[model samples]
Target: IVIGSGDLAAGIADQLRAHPDIGYDVVGIVPETPDPEEGAVSLGEVEDLPRLVREHRVSDILFVGAGHPDRVLGTLLVKLADAPVTIRVLTDLESITLSQGVAEEFLNLPMLRFERRNLVHLRPWLKRVADFLAAAALLVVTFPVQAVLIVAGLLARPALAWEERHDYRGYPHRIPLFHDPGTGWRGALFRALPPLRYLPSLWPILTGALSFVGPYPEEPDENRAMEDWNLILTRLKPGVLDVTSIADHPWVPFRDPAGLNMYYLQHWSIGLDLQIVLKESLRVWDKEEGESRHG
Candidate 1:
């Protein structure tokens, strides 16, 4: 559905409706004026918006025209706060992404989103399920190596160390790891096998407290949860591997965790997660191989 109907609404609606491949099905419109153009699927005037949205089950809402806060726009935003619909406004303005709103192209027209929804989405759950299975499989394959490490830790007398991290919703997560192997061939071997440090995290994945790919967990910090993007990251469990840490080109200058994490959340899918996992394994192998050759 679209708000502020006129030429802007009609043009955008027609373009999206014409292109089936674009995946936008404009079901109806909500003009600010009572008199919308003739023959358009005008649901009703501005006052009737909330009712129309709930009645028609609108998944997305596009507000036409310049995004200056008009009385109608201001009221509509507050009213629709609890509604589970994605909202965007058509704008040619420069991007103000990465903070409160995100800018993106909607059928070639620049659109701005004023809100970030931490709502329950099926894709996130699908991601969790996929991570859970991958973790299970890795644990099974590396059982022998894990057993050997456990035995070594036992004999070395500094078996395990517990570290504190925060998980979803600022819940405390106690992570267990084999203590430092020390400055010897044993330590070199441990460094060569970076994944050894993360084997304990596999169980959390099985328990749905971690993912195979997502935003890397930050150490306990009260301020992190208060930031806009960081607040969004709390929507899901931290991951065993940060996607860009493995998939991003080494020469790229942009490496801010907030920006990279926001990008990951915006474009995540099961296929993307699998691709990241494959790249992560290969990258780790390459690193270990290069280090071993030099060391």
Candidate 2:
């Protein structure tokens, strides 16, 4: 069942056509707009939902784009939670995704999560601890290579420019600060490397503006999109590496990995942090053609 004849609805249909294992029978497209483009089977506007539901036999409904998902979904939950056909929201909420229904049998989650107040307080401290550790470790592991890169950067006389990559999008990628202006690119490369990426982040750790492994601190303009990853970072530090970032994209568990600076918030933990780091190092960093397995 597909909703909204917009790109999201079309995109989901595309993905479903690509992955048959998804086990969904996508028969119709529902668009609020009067005229849907070519090749689309429009089920009419979302406001006439009862007719749409009846005509499409949409027992297990998925809201593709109903505006405020939280509010709109709440209404659907009240009306349809008791329906025998299981409903699911799309996973890739970036634009549109097939919302998978939470299995009823597994609804009882056992993990205890961090409270909002405690999570807020823990954020600053978690990064500081992670920063010190990451810096010290990277200094040891990459010292010789870093020295060569530093010397090459000094000799290269590379051009350094500070440009606003995206003004409307608040994620400002500034010219990375460097003592020797020529070495900015090298610095950028070094920072992109694992563990070393956290070195520059240490400064922020000192200032208390970030945590070691929390969600990527929202850029000033990112509050709109922050809702997507907020749950993942609620109790975790936004670290040098995101918890979800792994190599070969191999099987990153829904849980937090161990040792990459996680808090007790949101059923996340240090163990989960470490697992992510290990996956990053062994599977992600090890080879180019790695496949990530997700649960």
TM-score of each: 0.48, 0.41
- Reference-based lDDT, residue 83, model 2: 52
lDDT of 1 by residue, 94-180 (tens): 223334467778999656566766422226667877887888898899889778877887888677776655554446666676676
- Model 1 misses residue 257 by how many Å? 2.9
Estimate the Cα RMSD of every predicted model relative to the unseen true structure: 15.6, 10.5
- Candidate with best lDDT: 1
Q: Tens digit of lDDT per residue, candidate 2, span 1-295?
A: 5655456566556656555676766766655345646334675554555555656676666656645446545555565555554545544333211121232343573222323343322342454566566546755675676566546656774422222221112244332222333235664553334333334444443444433344433345434554433444444434434544531221221222321112223334455556655666554333422321221
Tell me how candidate 1 scores on lDDT.
Answer: 0.65
Error of 1 at 238 (Å): 1.6
Determine the C-alpha RMSD for candidate 2 after optimal superposition of all C-alphas: 10.5
**Cand. 1 TM to true fold:** 0.48
